[model samples]
Target: MHLIYLDEAGNSGTNLDDPHQPIHTVCGVIVKDSQWLPIETQIDALIAHLVPRVADREGFEFHNSDIFQGHGFFKGWPWPTRVDALERLLDIIVTNKLPIVWGAVDKQKHKAKYVYPAAPHDMAFLLCAERAERWFKNHAKDDVGMFIADDTKAKSDMKKSFKEYRKTIALGNRKECLEHIIDTIHFADSRETFGISFRMRLTISSSGILWAPLELSPFLSELNGMYMQEGCFRKKGAAK
Candidate 1:
């Protein structure tokens, strides 16, 4: 079995008029069951190295907003420190050769021009989940894929979408031929789940080119290139 962590990059809800969130993306960071422990160990080791230098910090989570603006525990940290820490965290994925499957929807473009019955956030998430299952089929046969998402009020909304997906896919009524997915996607706070936290950081860092106004070319370039090397879902199409 394979466990995948899902997270959103920019969620504008149903309101496309929200300028700050013009784009919405959902990404699932998937790794084989055997790789989880080693990756967790490596993440711990990296955090250990950075802790002694930054005081009053233990059990620190790698959040994009905090690292971007140097908030909370990052307030007094130098710019270089933040950059280095994020780089190392991203590097853990490459060092372990894990694959990331993501789906991005242009909210301003999609909702502004098209009509859909479902929420854009739920749609993007379900699409990403579809992609994750497809990638699992391509790489692993007969292995079930489970999803984990950030806990929210819409957690039930996401579950409903997944239920609908299974219904359609089962009856051969869906546009996307999705299968091999677990029934429910477990939800928990980001701070509680390392896998979800890892995927959130990946989603935010990888989305630098999308909504983040900052010039994160180096960040996206490094992470995207490495993810490609490890096999990522082809954008606007099926997995390669």
Candidate 2:
């Protein structure tokens, strides 16, 4: 059996006319319940190995304000430290070949055109859920249970989205698997942070191959490129 958690980053609330900023990203992770502990241990070890000076708390203290500040601990690193951390985290998940599946969505192009049954965040959540469901279908021998950390202001919204997604799947759409039994819990920080904690015991499910949206893929790829190029480094004026 597998339990997966979903989460996103960036602003999905931006308007189409917002010239200053226009990209929203949804990031996620799927991990086996048993593997959570070993993965945390590995993450702790990695942080200790790569950044021994910062306190252990520092590793978990990522937030949007800090990342956007442009010059604190995040900006100090060559890459936005948080994004870099996320990348490193993903690398670990992939390298360990943890059963965990992960992905993201960028709303740059679909800003005004895409209209879904849920809010932007809920849409993001659905995207991750669909990705995980496909992953489990291909990799796991048994059914996979999904858990998403609630970020919605209204809990009912999340539930509604899940229900709608289930309907879509039941209809044999095959476009994406949005409908799956999902449980949501509220956690501090984004769900991806929690997903990152469980790195060692991760296992990929066996249901089907999970592929990201073709349209959103380019934006996510670009964000990753930016993180690698300049976002990872510590900026001149970020939070301390």
Candidate 3:
């Protein structure tokens, strides 16, 4: 069995016209059940190494935005130091050869393209789920997959969208019926789940793929190898 840790970045809800956040991205990292512990331990060690002075690392959460924007624990940290930490975190994913899947929605293009555009969150989540299902079908045919997503205020909304996809044709595409993903999404707090926390950077970096590719090239370039290419990163149903 496989557990897909899901997270989102740049979510502006129904207000897709937000000038600052023009894109919404949902990302999933697929981990085999057997390898989950080893990966968690690696992340725990990295956290300790990064914050050696913090006695209580148990409550510490690695927020990508915080680390990048010099907020929270990262405040007063030098630019190179902050960037180095993020790069080290990325190394964990690369070293483990984890497969990543993402769905990024360009809100302006999405809204203009459809008379009644699907909500950005809804579209992005559905796209990620679809790609996840396809990944299992292609690479891990015998294994079942599940989603463990970060608990957000939009939990009910996301659940509603997921339920619709699980039972019906989704995103105006007749081919989508997510049979590989077992049951509904399992939402959990990022503070408690290392799987979800480690994959959070993928969501933030995915938005960068559409928003500021050059600024995030180092991160995205490394991520390109991990991303499942069959779906090829969706943007309004078009593959990149």
Top candidate by lDDT:
3
- Each prediction's TM-score against the native? 0.80, 0.57, 0.85
The runs of at least 3 residues in candidate 1 whose Cα sits more than 4 Å from the true structure, single-residue gaps closed, are 53-59, 115-117, 169-177, 200-240
Clashes of 1: 0
Tens digit of per-residue lDDT, candidate 2, span 1-240? 455554444443634334433333344455667777787787777667656776534645334344435454456654445555645655665555544333333344455466642245555555656656766566563665766552556556656666667656431355654434455443444434656343221111222122222322222233323112223233334432
Which lDDT value does model 1 have at 5? 85
Writing each residue's lDDT as its tens digit, candidate 3 over 108-206 gives: 888889999989988888888888887888898788988899988888887788888887555554666777888888999889988877655443332
After superposing candidate 2, which stretches have Cα over 4 Å from the reference? Answer: 20-23, 50-59, 62-88, 98-118, 150-156, 169-180, 185-193, 196-240
Q: What range of 10 consecutive residues in model 3 has the weakest lDDT sum?
A: 205-214
Q: Write the per-residue lDDT of candidate 1 for residues 153-220, one digit (tens) a residue.
A: 88887888788776554313646555677768789887776787566433333243432223333334
Give the Cα RMSD of candidate 1.
6.1
* Better-scoring candidate (lDDT), 1 or 3: 3
Structure candidate 1, residue pairs in collision? none
Per-candidate local distance difference test: 0.68, 0.48, 0.76
Better of 1 and 2 by TM-score: 1
